[model samples]
Target: MEETDHPQYCGIGIRGVAIGIDSFVWIALLFVAIFITAAFTGQLETGSPGLNAELSGAPASMALGLWFVLALGYHTVFEWRFGKTIGKALVNIRVTSEDGSSLTFTSSLIRNAMRFVDWLPALYLIGIVGIAVSGQRKRLGDRVAGTAVVGS
Candidate 1:
């Protein structure tokens, strides 16, 4: 009857590990973006050994916005298209609708957007609590989006 009744849910611990892997990947991509941006903006020069990361003002704001967009898009695109990110696939877990179907683009976007709330007050502390107590092993994002992360 309700959308939260997912079967074969995974524990938050495994989810945590999967997210760690995903985060690592995101950070790597971001680093590459920063490197390229710096080069194009002339922050790097001939004989320069590394990128200068001390950029500020409008450039810093733009970089921050780019980071947010990339983070959102990374999760949204992977979950919508593949049901799982690389980390989730590697960990044998996936995001699926509450009724055990592939997530829609809307569902994935809603869930990923809620990631900010899930991280409120700390590093996913709210999400961890939600999963630990939601009875369906879901975080805020999953509940909001009518989705679940479960064994693949």
Candidate 2:
């Protein structure tokens, strides 16, 4: 019998657990962002009067912006450096191009940044649909970048 040339990917399209883990990380980061926003917004009522309401909006925006950066930027940089996110590492998976090579920085950046389109209008429903239908278990970003997540 001849062996397959391609690597075996996670059957359920990156697996529920991997997505769950990544979602957990994002949720924690979002919570922190909300807390920081609340703290500066004087909504905390913790008696920190020095925190100005006028300044609150900027910090909140900054935190929110950082959250986006952490999601996309960190993934691009760290995955380029290590071929895996903390979540992917925990799940023993790595992302690579379909041709079997580490993802390029340009591809990673384009893919992650383009998540805005994938997430447009609502609950990432488009991205989820894309992932489910893709043979490579890739979401919109993955498809745009020509990449796949596979077992390590």
TM-score, every prediction: 0.88, 0.72
Model 2: pairs clashing at backbone N, Cα or C within 3 Å:
none
TM-score (C-alpha, index-matched) for candidate 2: 0.72
User: How far does residue 2 in candidate 1 sit from its true spot (Å)?
Assistant: 22
Query: Per-residue error at 83 for model 1, in Å?
Result: 0.6
Top model number, lDDT: 1
lDDT (Cα atoms) of all candidates against the true structure: 0.85, 0.72
RMSD of each: 3.5, 4.7
Candidate 2 per-residue lDDT over residues 1-152, each given as its tens digit: 02236776654545556656787878877766666666756665444564332334677687788678777876788678887877788888877877768899998887778678877667667777777787766778888888777788
C-alpha lDDT (0 to 100) for residue 89 of candidate 1:
92
Writing each residue's lDDT as its tens digit, candidate 1 over 1-152 gives 14345367988889989999998988987776666666656664455674455556766666667778888899999999999998999999889998888999999999999999999989899999999998889999999999998887
